[model samples]
Target: MTQNERIFLPWWKRVVIVIATVIVFALQIMLFVFAFQVNFDFPFNVWIYWIIEGGSFVLVYHIIHRPILTNYKLTWSILILIFPLPFSLLYYLNQRSLALPKYKQKKIDTILGNYYNPNQIDCTLELDRKDPKAAKLARILRSSTGYPLWKNTKYTFLFDGLLKHEDMLVELKKATRYIFIECFIISDGKLLSELLPILKEKGDAGVEIKIIYDDLGSKATLKKKTILEIAQIKNCTFTNYNPLGLNINPAFNYRDHRKMVIIDGKTAYCGGDNLADEYIHQKKRFGFWRDNCGKYEGEAVQSFIALFIEMWYISTKMVLKLENYLCDYVLERETSYILPFGDGPSNGAEPGYDIFRSLISSADQTLYISTPYLIIDEAMIESIVLAAKSGVDVRILMPGIPDKKVAWYLGRFHYKDILLAGGKIYEYTPGFNHAKNIIVDGRYAFIGTINMDYRSLFLHYECGALILLDNEIYKMKDDFLKACDDSKPITYEDWKKRPWWQKLISYLLYLFAPLF
Candidate 1:
């Protein structure tokens, strides 16, 4: 079926596709096992079983000793122990693929050198003179991700995709040098319908345009013809990062979940909104779709430029001239630091997770978090609980209505703990709160696509901006407070009194939280 047809497929046809996909997936596993068994025919099968069993133990031991997260180790260990042959092989392959090949890494490192300035460390050093605690966090972010702390950057809070859509067009139309757009999902919807013409006009006018999206994430909504048309534009290039094929590997889970729109390296937008109709509320999949995106300027825009180029190199393996894209633009200066960084499973460091933990840990008076998915790990849970226990006014805002019921249920599983620890939990009554934001003591904020979930924190290629002492933070805080007003608070007593079935389901799902 054509891509457009897939989107408009009859319900029964879509159901058939889902069922067939599951069946094929199961068959693939079975065939893999069958092949393994057949390799050791007859009498040797018994010996091979013993060898496999021994190998499984060794793998389990290795997983335990690995310098990975506890949850990941548990998930892999359980799978390897339960299904030795396939899971063992899968684990081995996954470990081998976690890092980029030496040549690719060398090439990317070389590309990155074009953007780094040794003097930028002075930004962090200057921050130390103002707020030592914030400076410490900045140092950690710099050390872990190599993304510098940008000073005097202008930041704007686009409360929803509709607002972001307006700002994006304004910037896109003003593009003189180049435009880079990357999103997790880009569909044949109102957003894309509006964006393509501008891109075409600019591309034909000798302005470079680069676009990237996740193949699996957009396959259901983006048409093949749309992709072809985008590629056909003059001076335009498009990539569906980590394209799907018959090859089954852990790489499938590592999607490019980052979203950004950069114009001339002078301005950029990053946040939870994908290039879809629902994001801008042009087509309502749920109730009013609540989301956010931040428009950025100043030295910080350079970090976003570097981020796009990094992903571009990873996806296309052809590094564009860095000098061609990096533009040093002046900004209407604000006294805030913006650190734009990208994280992924391949990066060997969990900057997203670390930043979340750091933000939570640094909160003194108040901590407010907004995430569509609150399915977080134990470390995150402990940090929030500890903050609340230490007299911090911690409030977590989650979706009242869910796009994914299982994730919603899993999120509720931890509400009781936070509630008991004096942390407030609210469900947005208007609709899904799709924004991934964290505000600390009204002084620091994170506005980006890194959700408080395992997939975003540890698996996907995610990006976001960490803003320190930005005036826009008050705007974000006000929005959060207003959202809290529209939300329904969850009391510990009420949570304990939930339906038995929901409790049972949540508990069952909690066991597999890492995988989700």
Candidate 2:
């Protein structure tokens, strides 16, 4: 087996890790001394620095000496020989607090208790085929098993960013109740210029408007003053999600990476497109940045509204009343099946990863996935491998030129394993493919802001729709096939013959995949 296939750590590497732990502990002691010299006048600040530096020493010591420390005799010997009396007492207290078991609370069964009447809802689209592939694909568009979400909704697939911007502006102009907009990136571009004026106009006309955008995602593209000025002038509210700074929590890994617009809780717009010109090919970089988005009206619009409201509350710390925002103006349309689902780190019971896993396992005929970042975890990799082994045709499309070189190499590292398991991997030769989509068995399609990576699965906040047996599925499938025609396939033999230095770099990257 190759290094990537092995799960165990080598003995030499373990020894090196132990040596590094000792060095880290020594560095922490030096930091503590330096902090004391500079912070003697400020007792509180000195204590804080000591707590941080001393905690690092204790952590490193425990990690390095864990095996030996487990034995009572060796533990006593090391403690007596290593630490001064006061330091030993402090370490003992810290360890005891960490080990103590706190009170456990019983899980409350807060049953919203099936408030939905499935008989009253006609959202499921029946498929002609009874095969697993078809059923799995069909479920992508089906209403999730929770709360009868996305029922009685209308959907419009927007092909151009400019056109989408125009449609959104027109929708905002018609809003009579409320408006909620959430995005990962909102740049000062032609698209924003066209929509911002309309947003301000609606806000001034007594329409309730709320906006949430990621601070890091738009750091270089937007100015704080611009957004603040707009909020002040238009009587609108704006909040930045997870700002970037030295004191920011590492949990900033969980980002709001969705772009959505809901007008009056009746019409909603979502998909892979962000509020930028490049997404519409207006300001091209590597190539004409081809992308897709969807607009929905009907019951599914309610789900979109709920998602927006949930995010708004998290960002703004304000509770908005649904009755006040969603009353008589909701448009009732009859043609499409739309299921808008939000995925985030806080989804404890029904995680989006499980939903994705279910869809992949149910595929019996074919599965096609396109993603720019492909750093999938072991479970996802296993699903793809098993599907290929079961005689199901599985294909993935990745960019030939990557936005992140390390992630690109890590993805290439998996090509040999996938091909050996009977899957096909294609590279988009023209330029980067920023589209995140999956078309299963030609009957179900999923398009949204979630990438197939660790960040999207376990960290970042994301949202998307499952298009089951809808007209949009046909269009997405056709687009995928056309993309395949313009792509080059990678063979197992080709991958195995990659340069030794390239393989070594990819191997190192695989070790750090979890952090990425």
Report the number of the highest-TM-score candidate: 1
Query: Candidate 1: global Cα-lDDT?
Result: 0.83
The CA lDDT at 5 in model 2 is 27
User: How far off is residue 115 in model 2, in Å?
Assistant: 8.2
Q: TM-score of every model?
A: 0.89, 0.74
> What are the per-residue Cα lDDT tens digits for candidate 2 across 1-516?
122322333466566555654665576577667878888888888887666556545554553444311112222323322443554453443231232122110101121222333533333333223234444433533433343434356666675566677788888888877788899998887887777788777778888778899988888888767777667846588888867677524445567898998887778888777887787667767665656678887666666666676666566556665445554444554434456677764343224555566667767788888888788655567788999999989999888767787888888887876899999998887767777787777666677788887667656778887766567677777777777778778888888888898899888776556445
> Which residues of candidate 2, in runs, are more than 4 Å off?
1-147, 159-163, 246-250, 327-336, 497-499
TM-score, candidate number 2: 0.74
Error of 1 at 78 (Å): 2.4
lDDT of 1 by residue, 1-516 (tens): 122321243455446545644664465457557756776567477566667766776877787676666556666766776678987776755552453666877788788875675558687787888888878877778878988888857899999889989888988999998999999999898888898899999998999888999998999998889888989999998888988888766576588999999999889999999999999888867788999989998778888988898899989998877777777676656468888999985466778888889999999999999999999866678789999999999999999989998899899999988999999999998889999999999988899999998878877899998888788999999999999999999999889998998899998887578767
What is each predicted model's overall lDDT from 0 to 1? 0.83, 0.66
Most lDDT-accurate candidate: 1
